[model samples]
Target: MTTIEIDHTSRWFGNVVAVNDVSMTVGPGVTGLLGPNGAGKSTLINMMAGFLAPSTGKVTLDGKQIWRNEAVYRAIGIVPEREGMYDFLTGREFVVANAELHGLDAAAAGRALATVEMEYAQDRKIATYSKGMRQRVKMASALVHDPSVLLLDEPFNGMDPRQRMQLMELLRRMGAEGRTVLFSSHILEEVEQLASHIEVVVAGRHAASGDFRRIRRLMTDRPHRYTVRSSDDRALAAALIADPSTAGIEVDTTEGALLIQAVDFGRFTALLPQVARAHGIRLLTVSPSDESLESVFSYLVAA
Candidate 1:
């Protein structure tokens, strides 16, 4: 398996800079390209798949340029976000066409179809397939050549949990075989569950790149605000403020609750309950105030 490298790359469209000075190496393993919507993940994937060229620097696979290099397709397989596969062709025929493009025969198509478990409906035209079915068919096309490097863009979109799990298992296996697998996603849990390493992009800029847990810890270190209502609000706030983990605690007059800003998320979570128990305060509600994905993503972008 070969590693893909992006060195000082930047892409732009007239006034819009899609990817700005982002460089990273993706090697053998399942890597999650994490980003919010409109974060240029798609643009980066396209460049890696040789679908687009950067305005500056280079994208290479084992030191060979990827852009406009037809030979690179022999080593790379791509599943793009756009759903423009041959709809008139049957599932089997579609895969057969893909195999034929790789100079293989119908048997190669059948094997790829079987791997994705789409043989049952392989005879049906792709026009009748649902989004998830189309996804599996697209996956079959990418796998038909058994390429070492696989690039997928939002591969889990519109998939059910079972379908999602199946795809995840397949990717994990490919990664174990030393194939470089990179997929883009906006969801945190998908990346957290499937990838040990992650690269985060924000506002068309490379934000963070490394282990998922390390990036996660950086996010978790941000203040975690929560709203809590207890039997004795003042007493609970007093006890919570005594701990260094609690950055700031405010007693809301109209809301009749405590607004807590926790600098240390993990420590504060544990500290809050313990403080309540020890102070003999009964908690009526303990809801996280800033648990939305947008907030988490914005924080990463800001950082």
Candidate 2:
């Protein structure tokens, strides 16, 4: 099985460091690179794809260095996040061109298009396709060479629900076949649905690495912040503060809402409605303020 290893790796753009001293091993099966924007995920992926060299340490595929190695491209396929594809070409022509670059033929291009379920629109110009169609065509081009390792950077950018599910199934099957599949995503739900193993990066540092459930528990166990609005704000806050689940409560006079921090997510969620009803406070709005992946990454970094 193909494996990519990053050992004590760091990438810097002159004075700015994009990736810090981080290390990880990506083997067979699907692994999700979980990180917020500008968290060095793209930089790390670039090094693995041999598009960018690490400033320090090494990034290798198997036992060979990946930097400046053109031979490694035979074993690695990359679906970049950016939309730099040729809009003038049809889907079939674009995939055929990618196959040709790898010394492949029309048969290889056809198989790749079929794998991504893009054959129906293969004759259509890329400019005429939707966002989801464009993504599928990009995926087809990457799979044209049938590489052992696949690296997808934000592969589900603008896909609809159906298209997203289709891609997930394709990746799942690829992983089951023992190909090393690594996809970077900031969306928790996307990663949770696709990858059981995840590596989290925060502020250019490796924050956590393990099973998704374990890391998810770590994130959820922390105090959750929420913005709560009710008819009787003072009464609701007072009632919620008295509960053991609530750690703190702040009255936001400017927003006319209560900022609450809950220690026990499950207990607090159940307690909120009960307390509001007891105090005869009509709940107007109750929304999580720190549910974003950035917030979760920040908590991991602080820990």
Candidate 3:
């Protein structure tokens, strides 16, 4: 449908630089823009949606500029992260107004509501709707135009599990239809399950961009440090320390567990169970100390 390009773009706010000189391309398919809190992800999404301007570079849809460009709306539909949508209007009324803004009528509005499966509650006032309901209504308003590019910022912030799955499926279907769909999130599992492609950001800087598997491997390639408790700590540590895949290991006397720094994630994982079974050690608990996304992301960004 539409391709978006960000070229050496930078934005600032007085003394705080919001977005550094970063560049990337977002094309047809679901792309998860991932970053920690206050990492300028929302600022980047706003620029792409024509709601904000880059102070030092260009954000374009295909070849057309996205900033100060009202004509781009015909091809761009945005579901913003800000939770300030109209609360007085009913669902149907809100969607109808969105259609009217795009020079369409109520029929198109109704279809949009149906597409989001919100027709059943279309008559209810938005003021009484739940967070998830409000999210879906906002999605319907954005979909009313059937634009080529769809941009969503933190779209699943307050949604329940079922609502999250439904929205993910809808976005996947839209991407399959050749519509470019991009959403931002800080949750690693959400990005992993929803978007195969990922772009990671940290502290207003672009960290990594590629398939999720590559990123996952980069994060997992270093020694996977884990604390394990088993029936035989001494025996297990002795056996594991002999293996070349295990760089270092220590038996924690206070915690009564073994600290293992595994060099090869895949090899260590497979060797663990086999060694335990062969040595007749019943494992109590195995936990990775550095498995959190925050640490991984920080490492990637620092690199």
Candidate 4:
């Protein structure tokens, strides 16, 4: 399996730094690149695909320099995020052209289309295809060369639910085959479902990298803020504040709820219900106020 390494890599555009000093290794597996829009994910992927050079440090594939290296393309397949494909060409024609460019034949193109389950619509013009169909055709074109490393950017952007699941299954199978599959997406659920490993980027910086569940647990282990509404807010808050799990509590009169900060996630979750029941208070709502991925990532960056 081929491994892509970004060692102290940084890319800039004059005064604007797109990718900050980042170092990571992408090995064989389904790895998700998680970041917000304009977080320099595309820039990083460009450097990996040998389309853009880093301003500092190195991007290497199996110890070979990726920047200014055309030979690396033999082992790399890229599915770009933009929609600037050749619209006039049929899907089959498009894939065939890509195969030819890679010194491959029509059989390779046919196998790729079949792998993406797009052979049924391969004869149709790309202009007449739906967004998901176009995505599959693009995937077929990328896979025509049978590269070991596959890089996809926002691959599920316009796919329907079924289409999205189909593509996810395909990626899973590819990862199982030990192909180094790295995909960039801003959607948390997409990464959570498909990626065994994830790298998070925020504002051009590497925020976190690990198994999603482990990273999620790390995020949750921090101070947790919750909003709770109960039949007796004052009584509930009083009882909870006495517990060691709770660090602070405030009664928000405007919202008729208690804002609580808990230092221990597991202890607080178990303690809250028990405390409310003991005081004969019925809990109306118990919700984490800072459980969103964005909030979790922000907390991580702050730490």
lDDT string for model 4 (94-168, tens) is 999999999999999999999999999999999999999999999999999999999999999989999999999
Error of 2 at 262 (Å): 0.3
TM-score list, all predictions:
0.93, 0.94, 0.92, 0.90
Worst-scoring 10-residue span by lDDT in model 4: 291-300
Which residue pairs show backbone clashes in model 3?
Answer: none
lDDT of 3: 0.91
- Candidate 2: which stretches are off by over 4 Å? 252-256
219: Cα error in model 1, Å: 1.5
Global Cα RMSD, each model: 1.9, 1.7, 1.9, 2.3
Clashing pairs in 2: none
Give one digit per residue, the lDDT tens place, for model 1 in 167-249.
99989998998999999999989999999899999888999999999999888988889999999999999899998999898
Write model 3 residue lDDT over 76-142, tens digit each, in one string: 8899877787889999999999999999999999989998999999999999998888999999999
The collision pairs in model 4 are none
Across 204-295, the per-residue lDDT of candidate 2 in tens digits comes to 99999999999888888899999999999998988888889999999999999999999999999999999988878899999999988788
The runs of at least 3 residues in candidate 4 whose Cα sits more than 4 Å from the true structure, single-residue gaps closed, are 242-245, 266-287
Q: What total of clashing residue pairs does each candidate reach? A: 0, 0, 0, 0
Q: How far is 58's C-alpha from truth in model 1 (Å)?
A: 0.7
Candidate 1 to truth, TM:
0.93
lDDT of 4: 0.94
